[model samples]
Target: MPTHGVIRRFNDTRRTKEKMTPGDLCLLAHFYGVSVEVMALRLEDLNLLPNGNWGKLKAGGFRVREAQQQLGLGPLPAR
Candidate 1:
């Protein structure tokens, strides 16, 4: 689950229709059920990023885990 602050941030970003961030392309492509190749992401990899947050499998397998914190997304990929 997401924290209140995380939820608030999501809402604010949504309300503002801000520009896309690093991982947004992957998620939006997933949502639209389209190819993610432009983002250099495979459609199958979407499974490793549920709800737009890196899953445990991906967290351990990719450098993205480190980016999560660097990007202020949280420590445990619980975002």
Candidate 2:
């Protein structure tokens, strides 16, 4: 699927009014709390839960943050 199609599907499946455009998703994955690789893995491979497990996404974000730390990326650089 095209990137936009994937983004639309993600937003629809998650029922996230927060807009999961590529830009937002990239920002969320790369800078918010999750690492890009983890987010890509989860979002691309995991199924959405029927009982509202959006926290898992946040956890993915946290993992990204951790990866960034491990790779010497630092926390958002204080900007």
Candidate 3:
């Protein structure tokens, strides 16, 4: 699915911001055993974000951080 679609899903379900959070991206990165930057690059490579915008990726990263705090996921592990 496209990045927007994914973000929408998360937002709708979790009532989060329109943008995807960094914590969300971080969770995905951790699942894939990759860094958040790598995940963002991969998303861009997959044409998930329009025009490969890095700003959206960064916003998503922030959202993820917020989500993590709410969920008590604690600070992300050191890279």
**Residue 59 lDDT in candidate 2:** 63
Regions of candidate 1 where Cα sits further than 4 Å from its true position: 18-20, 23-79
For candidate 3, the 10 contiguous residues with the lowest summed lDDT are 5-14
TM-score order, best first, reads 3, 2, 1
Ranking by lDDT: 3, 2, 1
* lDDT value, residue 54 of candidate 1: 34
Tens digit of per-residue lDDT, candidate 1, span 1-79: 2235334444454576654344554444333344333222432243322443334335546454354445454332222
Clashes of 3: 10
- What C-alpha lDDT does candidate 3 achieve relative to the native structure? 0.58
Q: Count clashes in each candidate, considering only residues at least 3 apart in sequence or on different chains.
A: 0, 4, 10
What is candidate 2's lDDT per residue for 1-79, written digit by digit as tens? Answer: 2455555556664585644443444454554355454445556554422222345556645454444555566554444
Candidate 1: residue pairs that collide: none
User: Any runs in candidate 2 off by more than 4 Å, and if so which?
Assistant: 1-21, 30-32, 47-79
Clashing pairs in model 2, backbone N/Cα/C closer than 3 A: 33-61, 34-61, 34-64, 35-64
Which should have the higher lDDT, number 1 or number 2? 2
